[model samples]
Every structure is written in C-alpha cells, then in structure tokens.
Target: MKILQDFELLFQQELHKLYDNDEIKAIFLVVIAEKLGLNTANYQLSKKDPVDDKNSAEILSILRDLKKHKPIQYILNKADFYGEVFQVNESVLIPRQETEELVDLIIKNHKFSQNLNIIDIGTGSGCIPITLSKHLTNARVTTIDISKEAIKTAQENANILKTAVQFINADIFEWEYIFSNQHYHIIVSNPPYITPGEKKYMNENVLAYEPELALFIEESTPLIFYDVISSFALKHLAPDGDLYFEINQYLGAEMKDLMIKKGFEQVKLIKDINGADRIIHAKKAW
Candidate 1:
C-alpha cells in the first residue's frame, strides 16, 4: 500500500494535469484527507511528510475517481453554500457560486416576513428555498422540481439541514393545472437556461455528470421556462409580489424585455460575481 506521502505526490502530479484551478486541487486534497480520517491540520503542517498506508490507499482510490471526472462534492456527498454545508449527489445539480449570488441579491432586496410566501421553481437540492427559509425564519417556502430524483434529494437535504421547505414534485409547465389558484408573495427560479447549441462548449465534467434537464434549454425556445413561470406569476403572484430568476448570461436583455411585455414592472437584470448578466428581478403590478 502507498503511504500518505506518496499519495500526496501522486495527487499533485495528477491534479496538475486534470485541473487548471489551484484551489480545486487544494479542495480535493482536503477532501481526501477528510475521507481517510487523517488529522487534516497535522497533514497540512507536515505537508512534506509521508502519509500512513491506510490513508494512502483510500486517497489513491479517491484520486482514481477524480481522474474519471467525478465531482469532489459528489465523492464527498456534501457542499458548502452560503456558509452552510449541504448534502449533494449526482441526482441534483451542485450548488454553484452564481446561484449564491442570486440568493444574496434576493436577500438584500426583499423584506422578510412571517407571512411571506415564496416558491422556488426547479428547486434542485432545495438550495434556494432552504437557504431562504433559514434566513427568513418565518417565511413559508415551497420548492418544486420536475425530476423525481432531484425532489427526493432536495427533501433529504431539507431534513438533514433542519430547514422547513415544502418540496413538490411537478413540472413548472403543469403547475397551473396541478395547483391553479395558488399564489405567492415571491416567485424564484434558477431554471435550465443553457441553450442546446452551447452544449458542445460545456466542460465534460458538467456535460457528462450533471443532469441535462437541469442544464439545457432548447436553442429555439430558450425562454420556455421563463415564459411559463412568468405566466404563472402574472396569474398567481399576489399584487406587488416579486419574481426573480437566475438567467442565461447572454440573454439578460431579452429576458428583461419578455418580463416587461408580460406586464411585469421594474424588470431589471443584474450581474453576478463574474460580471456576467445573471439574474432578473421584477415586480407584479398591484
């Protein structure tokens, strides 16, 4: 069996070939240390020291998975978002930094209230709704997803996180038929916005591993989810209720225009950490 020292050397060399991000390598190493029950602090202290045999074997196994393009979060089964650790798996899309920025924008701009009812459409892993519920304390939050696997994973996450978020398994297109009269104070979605034409440009890790339904929108109808959700908001959003979406970076202006055309007021597109137009916010007329 290889020792920890040997594993570290192998990790460094293999990671250098696989990932360009230095921080990703650091995180992968830390996860490996964590999985092996090694003293992470001590391991850091003795960076040059050889790892013991048992830890080295486990880490070597993990490295093999990583080389296969398995996401570290899926291998670890947990991810950190908005200062909280969340359970994650292949069943749900990994929580992303861009979505965190969307959540931050929502929290910063919206007033919290016990009676504020919020719905998060396409709620993968329940990240947005659960985080909003944790922060809002008394807000009534409901999350919906078309994928049964995603819904199940999201429900498990809610239970584990000890956050109260109502999970519903239903497609947004069928929402009106399923729950016609339901209205909310806030409606939010980070729907599948990647155009099908862009699939070739996405990394293999994402294209191969992440759920395609949660990633792609047909190039011909890129605004499919937006159109459906906006229609729902128009008919069901309480007067003066807000609608929020994490949108395709390349189509923010078009999204804003669509919202305005649908009778939404104050339609605005906001940039994310990468300075990409990433979120759209609008209010239903009272």
Candidate 2:
C-alpha cells in the first residue's frame, strides 16, 4: 500500500486535467483526513503513514469517481453551506455557495426583525430554510419540494443540523391551496431555472451526478418556477413582505421584469462572485 503522501501525488496526477492544482490538493487533503480519521491539525504529521489495504481501496474508488466527474460532495455525501455541514446525496442538488449569498441577504434584511414567517419553495438539502431558521431565531421556517427523496434528504440534514423546519413534499402548484389563507414575511426559492437546452453548457459533474428535476426547467416554459413562485408570492406574501430567488444569471433581466409585473416593489437583481446576476429580491407594498 502507498503512503498517504504518495496517494496525494496520485490524486494530483489523475485529477489535474479536470480540476485546478489548488482544488485537487484541497480535495486530496480532505479525502485523506476524513478517510483516515484525522483532523486538519494532525494531517501533516500523518502524511507519511502507510494506508491499510481496505482504506486504500476506498481511496482508489474515490479517485475513479472523481475521474468520472462526480462531485466530491456527492462522493462524501456531505456539503457545507453557510457555516453548517449538510448531508447530501443523489436525491437532492448539492447546496451551493451562491445560495448561501441568497440566505445571507435575507438574514441581513431581517436580522433585527422577530417572529417572522418564512417559507422556501425548493427544499434541496434543507440548506436554505435550515440556515434561515438558525440565524433568524424567532422565525417560523417552512420548506417544500416536489421530490419525496429530496424531502427525505433535506429532513435528514435538518435533523442532523438540529434545526426545526416544517417540510412539505408537494409540488408548488398542488400545494398553493394549502397556504391560500396564509401569509409569510418572506418567500424564497432556488428553483429549477436552467432550460433543457442549457444542459450542454453545464459541468459534467452537475449533469451526470445531480438530480435533473432540481436542475432543469422545461424548455417551453423555462421560467416556470420563477413565474409561478413570484405569482404565488403576490397573494401569499404578507403585506410589505419580501420575496427572494437564486436565479439563472442569463435570466436576471427577465426575472426583474416578471417580479415587477407581479406587482412586487423594489425589485433588484444582485450579482455573485463571478459577476453573474445570481439573486433577485422584491418586496410587496405594505
């Protein structure tokens, strides 16, 4: 069996073409640390130790999966969002850094507010609602997802994270009636906005490993979720309540117009680190 340091070199040699040198190194360290039951602090001291045969097999399997472009998060079955670690799997889309920005923006907007009611429409990994529940301490957070498997994964994350979020396993269209007489201080969604045609442009890691239902919108109705969720917010949002979305970068202008047409005020499109229009915010008139 190879020493841990040698496996690091192997990881770099095999993954260099697909990942940057820095990212590959980071992944290598994390995989070794997790696999060997060592934390970051002790990692350097253990690098020269020879890995046992069984552990070596697991490392080799991970390398093979990496070569196939499967995300490291899926391989590990865990993801970090905001400041919390969340369980993840093939059933749910991995929590993204861009979505963290969306959650942070909402927290900043309502940081001092209390007893708010917040409902998120897409409950992948329960990251959004769970993070909101943790930060906005007095808020009642509820989330919905169309996929039962996704809801199960999100619930598992919520339990693991020790956050209470009411989860609903229902399509937004079928479940609107359940909230007809209800109103919320905020409604948020990181819905499926990528059109079918855009799949070719997405990373193989995302397309091949992630759930398609959480990634693509129908080509004929590319903005289906945004349109429906924004319209739902029109009626279900409390007076002066806010609505937020993690949107397609290419569709920001269209999103702003749609929210305006839905009569939401103060519509704004915000850019992510890559300067892509990634989040949208709108407020209902008080």
As for candidate 1, its clashing pairs are 4-51, 5-50, 5-51
TM-score of 1: 0.93
Candidate 1 lDDT score relative to the true structure: 0.83
Give the per-residue lDDT digits (tens) of candidate 2, residues 54-103.
99999999999999999999999988899888899999999988998899
lDDT tens digits by residue: candidate 1, 115-169: 7889999988889999998887588999899899998888888898888898889
Candidate 2 to truth, TM: 0.95
What TM-score would each prediction reach against the true structure? 0.93, 0.95
Show model 2 residue runs off by greater than 4 Å.
39-41
lDDT value, residue 237 of candidate 2: 91
Model 2 error, position 284 (Å): 1.3
